[model samples]
Target: MSSYSGNVETGGAPDVRNLPGLRITKLSVGPMDNNAYLLECLSNEDLLLIDAANEAPRLLELVGDRALSTVVTTHQHMDHWVALEEVVAATGARALAHPDDAEGLPISTSPVVDGDRIPIGDCELEVIHLVGHTPGSIALVYRDPKGTPHLFTGDSLFPGGVGNTHDDPEAFASLIGDIETKLFGALPDETWFYPGHGKDSTLGAERPSVPEWRARGW
Candidate 1:
């Protein structure tokens, strides 16, 4: 777990890769240049994307006829999901997310919840609740036998800041508390955070920033 998170800028495309057990790649999309990730966990062909938005052409180019498994979303934001139907059409993969986030999706689907685990090849993904950014937002934890745990957080948790919120002040605070109680402070120092909009970070790297974030009351 390292705090070496990358703060990517707008317009730049997401970096692509094929890692052990999980092939995670980031796609830059939307007006805000949100990041959408495409993953191939175990067995190399089943693709699971974290978020899909503006870069349909590039995303398709990346897929290039691979077998798609599913599209898992952290939460529903238009920039993170505008190209969903295209993703589904191209890959024949279903879109899944927390039930609270279903309302925010372009197409309708049943909401996902905490404690649900979905399997992809030999890997298993555990859904964790860290609902601060959005009432239905979720963080996905994927642990491989290699001992590195990956946390795919939507807008909930980030490297130095949490997701932006304007709905309920109490809920926003609650979300922050949840991240402390259940995420960076709660999980092992090595847990990796894969956020929806920015670069990758870890528990050790993101922990010290929490108090500062809370201090500003943002």
Candidate 2:
């Protein structure tokens, strides 16, 4: 197994313990630097994987001795699920994704919609459907016992700007709107969001740039 560090070359494995009962492990894989996450609910050791982009062996090793309960695909993009089939087959975990992108997946997916609650041991992950990046790109929000929020965003909202809309005006508008209202407007500033690739960011850090992003029409 590769060493557990935040560096991608060393598997980008982070030392668990971002929140009280949440242990987050990140791995950067594939040529695109796709990020795959292992969310361990420490209370009962229940595990939920967000994106299975690549490197099945390393992902499996990250699971260690715990049974992987669910694997949630953030979107239907091939880069985000390159290792989906192998990981699911190895773990026997149910695959969950939005219905819009479910058909693009190689394996059967238990469809998820907005306002759905996915249980992870004592914690519950609230599904927030955000469009524009993809027809069904979704984000998972988990509120710790102390009220701090943790978000798992696929390709929708990133650290700098919203996910690529391919330069379409409407798509860009929709994406920014969803993020502004659903994420920024609703969640607190301290919410830490983990995207499908690259570094994580908090609402407070990125909140000020919303208007600028909208004005630039990106």
Candidate 3:
């Protein structure tokens, strides 16, 4: 596998990671600098996109001539799906999102709850529902048999803290609590996590800050 920094800039080249059986491409788009991820199964070339964000043309170009199997929206936030309808229309890919945030999307989406597995050629991504960022925000977990786990956390988890809860203590508590138990508590320290925006981070790098994040209440 090549060294992937997971660093991307809007209108620039995407950072690609070649894993054992899958390839991950990360791109930054829109004014919000939302990060969109493309996962391709090496065996069959099955493609899955996480978050359309913006710049439909660029996302479509990223897919090239290949068909996109699915597009999974992490949350109901507007910035995350600005290109969703266009991309899905262009690729004829199935749209998937959590039920609570499904109505916020431009098009109809198949609801996926926690524990649901989304197939991508020979590999699959497991769903992990995380609340607070939105009524139904989710993360995707890809457990590579030959390597450590990978997570797509959307706006739920970031390098320094969880997603914004609008200063609502209740919401922040819920998000942090779920992240601690479901993410930090369950996944290994080596697990690499890609967020909806900005840079990527490993679980081990952020584990020690969980207490601080909770205390800060962001």
Model 1 score (lDDT): 0.75
lDDT of 1 at 192: 72
What candidate 1 gets wrong by more than 4 Å, as runs, is: 1-13
TM, every model = 0.88, 0.93, 0.99
In model 2, residue pairs whose N, Cα or C atoms come closer than 3 Å (at least 3 residues apart or on different chains), thus clashing, are: none
**Overall lDDT per candidate, in order of appearance:** 0.75, 0.88, 0.96
- List, in order, the clash count of every candidate structure: 3, 0, 0
Ranking by lDDT: 3, 2, 1
lDDT winner between candidates 1 and 3: 3
For candidate 2, lDDT tens digit of each residue in 35-136? 888888889999999999888888899888789999999999999888899999998999999999998898999999999999888888999999899999
* lDDT (Cα, tens digit) per residue for candidate 1, span 1-218: 32223455566655654446876676666577687777776574677777776677777777777777778777777777777878787877878888877887887665668888877766778888877687788888887677678788888877778888775678779888988887766578888777887677888887777889887766
Model 3 pairs in collision: none
Decoy 3 TM-score against native: 0.99
**Which segments of model 2 are wrong by more than 4 Å?**
1-12
lDDT score, residue 7, model 1? 52
